[model samples]
Target: MSRIGKQPVALPDGVTASVSGQTIEVKGPKATKSFTATDDVTLEVQDGVVVVTPRGKSKRARQQWGMTRTIVANLVHGAKDVFKKELEIRGVGYRAQMQGNTLKLNLGYSHDVDFDVPEGVTVTAPKPTELVVEGTDKQLVGQVAANIRDWRRPEPYKGKGIRYKGEYIFQKEGKKK
Candidate 1:
């Protein structure tokens, strides 16, 4: 049995979850999110809580049990709260700024890199070196942050690049004289 899957997801005071067929829809004050489980798992809402169970004893069914439960829990939580990510740009000339819905990046490149913000996600630059990504959906927020970091990953030589706040870059020693 799955330990996490055994636990039902509790609905918040203002949140309500309804299951139709294999799809579970959760609505809260902030947003509404839904998830459709595979045939390997079954989902239901009972007594103000959402429960997930495996449809069979197979390995795939067992794996989907816990995974589906977590996804449902996330939906309930994310519906009411916003997920956030912080990024720090490191380099002498590297910086970031927002122009309307676009993110202008100067990552020591020949030309500036412009990233168009996607729907359902908000990207902000409080300081030239600091970036904040926020959204109701966790996956979209994280993906936006990752996409920005990929523009200029931290280098081992000088550790100059865009990286998550509090992230440590392993520095390498310089070549011998």
Candidate 2:
């Protein structure tokens, strides 16, 4: 049996969940999100709780059940509360700013890279070198943060560029004479 898959997902007040076909719809006070189950997984809602089960006694089905359940749980939680990702810009001349709904980054590039913030997601720069990404959807929030980080990933030599707050970068030594 799958430990995570067998766990019951509790529904918070003002949140509603329903299973139709292979789709699980969760509606909260703030927003609503739907997730589709894979071929080897099944989703069911009972008495205000959601359950995930494998379709058959196969290795693939077993593997998917737990993962599907976790995704569904995240969706439910996201509908109620926002998820956030924080990044810091290190090195001279590295900075970020918010222009309306777009994030403007200066990462040593000749031209600034402008990233558009999608609906339901907000990007804010508390300080020129600190950025915060907030949204209800976990996946979307994380993906956007990753995209920004990819624009100018931190280098080992100088530990410069964008990186998650408190993330450790292994510094490389200079070449031997």
Candidate 3:
């Protein structure tokens, strides 16, 4: 039994949802997002709530039951509000800034790194060492933050690199004589 799949997703005020075949579309003030569920699960909207149920008792159907529900819920949330991810540069010379539509990064490299901002997502650097990635889609926002962090992941010794805000790095002891 999938407990999570049984719970219905409620549509908040100013948010609306529609069902067309296997696809569900959620419309809100900020944006509209749609999701197409696999045949293993059934999607329906009833009395302003979205429901998901597995078509059969097979393993694959059960595996998709909960996942389908979560995806539908994410679409509802994404349409209503923006997902944000914050990144902090820990290195001494590492920093980032927005130049028009591009994000200029200085991660102690010989040449500066530039990242192009994608549509529906906004990358802003209020401070040189701080970055905020905002977008309607949670997946895109997280992916952008991960790509930025991948440039220079924090090391254990000095903890020098880019990392998510409030994330802790396990420091290792330096070489001893």
What are the models' TM-scores?
Answer: 0.96, 0.93, 0.98
Query: Where's the lowest-lDDT run of ten residues in candidate 2?
Result: 42-51
Looking at model 1, residue 73 earns an lDDT score of 87
Off by over 4 Å in 3: none
lDDT string, candidate 2, 69-162, tens digits:
8998898899898899999999899999999988999999899999998887899999999999999999999999999999999999999999
The count of residue-pair clashes in candidate 2 stands at 0
Q: Give the winner by TM-score.
A: 3
After best superposition, candidate 1 residue 158: deviation in angstroms? Answer: 1.4
Error of 2 at 11 (Å): 1.2
Cα lDDT tens digits for candidate 3, 103-153:
999999999999998898999999999999999998889998999899899
Candidate 2 ranges with C-alpha deviation above 4 Å: none
lDDT against the true structure, per candidate, is 0.94, 0.91, 0.92
Q: Per-residue lDDT for 1-177 in model 1, tens only? A: 999999999998999999999999999998999889999998988899998999989999999999999999889888878889999999999999999999999999999999999999999999999999998888899999999999999999999999999999999999998
lDDT sort, best first: 1, 3, 2
TM-score of 3: 0.98
Runs in model 1 deviating more than 4 A are none
Query: Better model by TM-score, 1 or 2?
Result: 1
Worst 10 residues of 1 by lDDT: 73-82
